[model samples]
Target: MANKFIIRWITLCIVLVVASIKPIEADSDRFNACFESCNEKCKNDDYGNAYCEVKCDFDCGAKEVSAKFNIAI
Candidate 1:
């Protein structure tokens, strides 16, 4: 009984660790995609509505990337 309980506890800890890591990985991927897309848009058009859209996308992506890595900027 004690051995079974110990095994369960270890399994739970491993699962928690993995769950936490998964989100960081996913957020990083999202940030990278957003950044790349925003850069492309900005490069294609550098003024007016296109500029605003690109800036917003870049800011949001940077925020997500910083948050995911616990970076301050």
Candidate 2:
């Protein structure tokens, strides 16, 4: 009985992992697009890569929030 319970738990974990991967795969294109936009804008920055990355994140977050509220950032 203990072995059967362990097997079921393992099976459930495996199924959950398989189910979760598909949505992340589907979102890869959008992720890549956002990364590319950040990369381009950050490339010419005077503060260098690290600072630009932080700035890009802030900019993206602000854009998303403003867009969510139907306002332009």
Candidate 3:
């Protein structure tokens, strides 16, 4: 019984780890896209570097949170 319990616990941990990994990749892709657009605007002096950073974080966080919660952004 103890061995079975240990196997189940390990299985749960592996599943959780795999599930969490997918979101990291998705978030990375979102950030990359945001960076590209922000870089272009920053190059033109549309906003300061700080503003770009804030926008990138806000945009990426909003997207990830909405997707994770199944809420429409």
Task: Provide the RMSD of all predictions against the true structure, rounded to 1 decimal.
Answer: 8.4, 6.0, 5.2
Task: Give one digit per residue, the lDDT tens place, for model 2 in 1-73.
Answer: 9999999999999999998785312344554567668867788665688777777767666665565578965
Shift of residue 31 alpha carbon in model 2, Å? 6.5
Better of 2 and 3 by lDDT: 3
Q: For this target, which candidate reaches the highest lDDT against the unseen true structure?
A: 3
Give the TM-score (vs. native) of candidate 2: 0.44
Q: After superposition, how far is residue 47 of candidate 1 from its true place, in Å?
A: 7.1
Cα lDDT tens digits, model 1, 6-63, are: 9999999999998878433446567667777766766767556667566857696678
Model 1 segments more than 4 A misplaced? 1-47
Regarding TM-score, does 1 or 3 come out ahead? Answer: 3
For model 1, give the RMSD to the true fold: 8.4
Q: How well is each residue in 25-51 modelled by candidate 3, as lDDT tens digits? A: 456776678777766776587678778
How many clashes in each structure? 0, 0, 0
| Cα lDDT listed for each candidate | 0.74, 0.70, 0.77
What are the TM-scores, per candidate, against the unseen true structure? Answer: 0.37, 0.44, 0.48
Worst 10 residues of 2 by lDDT: 22-31
Error of model 2, residue 52, in angstroms:
1.1
